[model samples]
Target: MTSSVRGAQLARLLGQWHALPGRHRRPDYAALAAAVRGLLSDGRLPLGVRLPAERELAEALGISRTTVSAAYRALRETAHLTSRRGAGSWTTLPQGHRVATSGLWAAGDDGDVIDLGVAASPAPDELIGAARAAADDLPRYLGSAGYHPTGLVELREAVADDYTARGVATSAEQILITAGTQQALDLVLRLSVPAGAPVLVESPTYPNALAALSARRARISTHGLDAATGWDGELLLGALRQGRPRVAYVIPEFQNPTGHLMDAALRERLVATAHTAGTELIVDESFVDLSLDGAEMPPPVAVFDRHSRVVSIGGMSKAYWGGLRIGWVRASAPLVQRLAAIRVGVDMASPVLEQLVAVRLLAQAPQIVAARRAQLRGRRDALLGALRDHLPEWTVTVPAGGVMLWAELDGPISSALSRAAEDVGVRLAPGPRFGLDGTLERFLRLPFALDEETLTEAVKRIASVRYDLDRGARPTWRAPAVIA
Candidate 1:
């Protein structure tokens, strides 16, 4: 038996069911069953969510109990719902359904397997030196309880100073340390947006962010971000005016996967728009430091925030080593305090040694950034060249800065291609993982964080897989859309 939802809750989740297309042409029970199927297929109704009892749901929807029973029976026939005598019905994917996984792909134990799924780089040698320095400096905190829920004072000040240098004046009091940008995003979304309230996001935004928002059950509103033109300002502004979402999450600088940087003028306009609509803006600047063009980057969007409506999240995972696991949230002091209090209920505090190492790493930002840019530039060039030489049919945009290339395939078969690649010891994240409604199937995010030899081999394997797929080879099994 799956977890059950109350009749009122199920009714709320099925908002505007009657407005679905073709309702007038079908019977009441069939239309209702079709609506449920659409919700399950599109991920609006998550797997294992027990539906309301027939009589209770009938009362809530103002329908006869027989209609509700018939609808449930219809769903049972389709295998979208399963129920036991005592246990109520729950939603599920039909057998043989192929959907994109909602999170990062896991690496298999095979050493020869190439993981193009995750965009992460190896730690620099400086990490060892910083760890040693942090170990030497760890004695100072030994006298205390060592559980600083907010963060170490020195690390907070360092983060503030870094932001200050970037033209956003920040203070230690306004910063809350998190495990990483993922946790920072999770905390901000949970604390700021109410369940069922509208929340705006970029359509082809980060996958993990979508997962976080979906987990919160926030009413998501999306505006498209073109790979060529970056964000559509008019579309976003219109959504702000009409949707009036409680929170707007954006990756303004060096956006993930797309690698398009949001201009400073557009940033100001977005901040102004969000402010006018009374919606708080959450700016994720995790990719800000990875610019490969050597051009002067714009200041954070928080610089344009006068109404305290912008909350910025910065992290070390992209620019520096992900092993440090240090990220921070910059907001008003009161909001910082609230997030910190919430943090206590989660993990209490981040690792003190990691905080200390992050403090040292902050002081070495210049050197670390230079080295990262050089390595990433080389890898990016190599991958682009290999793709041009091997898979010329795929169109790719060279991101000015960032770890991945968003490539458009010849057809909407990214899921099928990924499944085929897995058979050849290559893993990929299909395009639908980054969008709603199972869209963007023609795109794939290819990471350039690996060595040239590894990347070349991976692309060669992918090409081979594509060949097999084109020749009518079928995948034996399907990857689950939601991984454990």
Candidate 2:
């Protein structure tokens, strides 16, 4: 790629590097430094990968080498890197380069390279003011023990109200707030799923959900979503009905990575199928609000949960901000009570500050929605255009809305593609990250939450890296599991 082309691409990618927690500060220099620190801390950028030369990386990031050098120097002085004359500076692990890894909360991480791992975006600028003002409204809970096991009444009420706003009839008694959606899902699975019981999930579902269920030793089964035709609602419903699964967890709204939204009719029928099969429908609506193209809203799975068989999980992570550490579960009152009992034994409750912030943030829902939609829109267009230009051999389906995107690599270059990305300065979530059986080997998920310029650069780098990977040697890729 030419410098001008790379520079333009880098500009698009780096533009989306908004000021995140401990990442970007006011001055671009400070921001890049903190970003480097974040990469190292996140382990997306490992200590020693022999980063791309200063000029290449600089062009890829659309910045001057001086800034990159200063950032590297700062990290090196902090023992985050080691440099020797004639040899490029190699980032060193914090405690021991051999094994010890820095925690994500640590201050220095930018020294490492390749950070295509995080699937998050910075909070809207409006959140800071909202959060500051919301603190003043928190005095009422200060006198109490601050041990809200189910969550603050206001936040729970807000969540229920939001459900109602989404065309679902919900009440505060039906809701319980935890520390974001992950915990909420964890709580429900912990309380409901039994050992060795059949757990049905969409193939290429969120990986963490599989982990949680697996830790419980559940007999996990999958209903594969066809990329060519999107999802097969009838087949999935048939499987659920025929097998009578114990639990069916799904991301119906803008389903993760694939970004395919299940139609409303499908959701209704699936809910009925679960009810008939005596299965609990665990519906995750985490990405419901990420409509990048102003597309029609996909109805929440909870909307069809009238039979009381559906359990709902919503969070502030994907929809709002990940750092908030707040999410909630809406189910029957009895089920909520059960999870609450299970939760106290796990971790008391989500922090009061976060709950307070969530409540405050809920008040500005319109603003958050608008900002997120706008950012995603720009990111989607940029990524689509870049892929079309540079990686013409690859295949990409522009999703209507979602933080992450599911794309095919023309061929089964999933593993090779990942290695190629690592060769440059990108760490991508492989298609297998979305599934357990490794059927997603031909696919890749990219989060467009980054800026347009950064998205372009990331794609260009991946393309260049792929070309490099294909040249001399052909590595045997993992054989994706054959669909039965």
Candidate 3:
């Protein structure tokens, strides 16, 4: 596209009455910097594409011209973008770098014990074979320069079609590939919530999501999670009804750590509540396809919404393999356009080669699911049984789908236990990380991502540790005396 036409398109995009957002009005320098980095990473803006002039962009985005000028200066300083005579400002690639080599979140050392840290199980031999086959198809991608921003078209259509097959019918136009669900969630948050706005997430949910939200300085209100009763429809429904948060974030299908499914009816109602309140619902189904025991799961929340009120996030990291690092968002065409705009500023696009691999996986879905299903089932049983056998007093909910068991210890020793477990080479996620307060101290998130032997060894290691410190010898509640 020529600069004039591109500029005109940009004008129309900005002309659409500015929803630049209330919280975004003040202009956060760090966020703007991160956004600039994201855009350059993705090729949507491309190297050497002239940025809209400061004054013009300020008017277009309906923000102060000072903010735009400051943001441009910030990007220029970082070398993410530069300005020169006779040319407007332009975005440039980060100098000689690997995109995934660095980021806010990172994996722990491989030597760590029972790294229940990652929610993904190791790839089975079958997937390896499939990936090998996928590699064989790579020569085809060579026809192009491999800079696919919206992901390979085949993968986009296939991802959309998979949901369609599940009765939630989606079209390829609604899809955009990402590095993983993490990136998908990040981008969704970037587009949906302005800095310092409220974004609702479940209590006792994944810590990384909280980290992402925190990094954005978003106001977080967590709905209650009763591990005893599984997921309470009334609690969530009440929270949504009352809080009226800007977004409702949930992992309805076998939620991480919690291993509970939001009631199906509530899924529909939740979507309705979001739309009624003008908030968006981001249903993270990263673990949806990894169900154990053949227990059926309702289609994604996106399936129940006609509009784009609910955006379903998925990735190959959890279900198929973590190394895939490819996830996607399914939304209405308009939202995709908005998300693409945000994405263009964030990372540009997911790796083109990975998208190809994902398309190949989608092609072989039937055989792959059958084999993965059996493996996950075995791991689930083993992990559950080990938890029961060792921590006999602890409660491990019967997870209908997904890896990771949300185990509540009968006693509170997680602080000492986590430290001890690390000594045993087994690094477990302390439950407190999942909640804002120390409420999850009596709980532990054990991912069944490891094989039986590893799970067994981890259980044994924990059982041997003694958390009986003199500070507080026995399990005790911290509540003050109730006035009956």
TM-score, each model?
A: 0.81, 0.76, 0.73
- Mind giving the per-residue lDDT tens digits that candidate 2 earns over 219-338? 998899876557887789889988898999998877876888888888889888888899999989888778777777866777777678999898888768888888889899998999
Poorly placed runs, candidate 3 (over 4 Å):
1-112, 467-484
Instruction: Name the lDDT of candidate 2.
Output: 0.73
lDDT of 3: 0.69
Question: Candidate 3's residue-wise lDDT over 1-484, tens digit each?
Answer: 4242243334442222222122134345533444445333322234556777777766666667787778778787666677887677776644443222111111233444356656776664556666677788889878877766667788889998888988887888889888889999998888888888888888888777887887788889988788866667777777777878888788888887788877768888888877877778988888778766776677678767966688889888766778888899988878887888788788777776677678777787777777777777888898878877876878777787778888887665444456445445566676766766445657888888788888988887877663333232221112222333
Question: Which residue window of length 10 is worst by lDDT in model 3?
Answer: 98-107
Deviation (Å) of 339 in candidate 3: 1.4
Q: lDDT for each of the candidates?
A: 0.82, 0.73, 0.69
Clashes of 1: 0
Given candidate 1, what's the lDDT at residue 14?
57
- Candidate number achieving the greatest TM-score relative to the actual structure: 1
* Candidate 1 residue-wise lDDT, 68-181, digit = tens: 999999888767789889877888655645333321122332466687878889998799999999999999999988899889989999999988998988999999999999
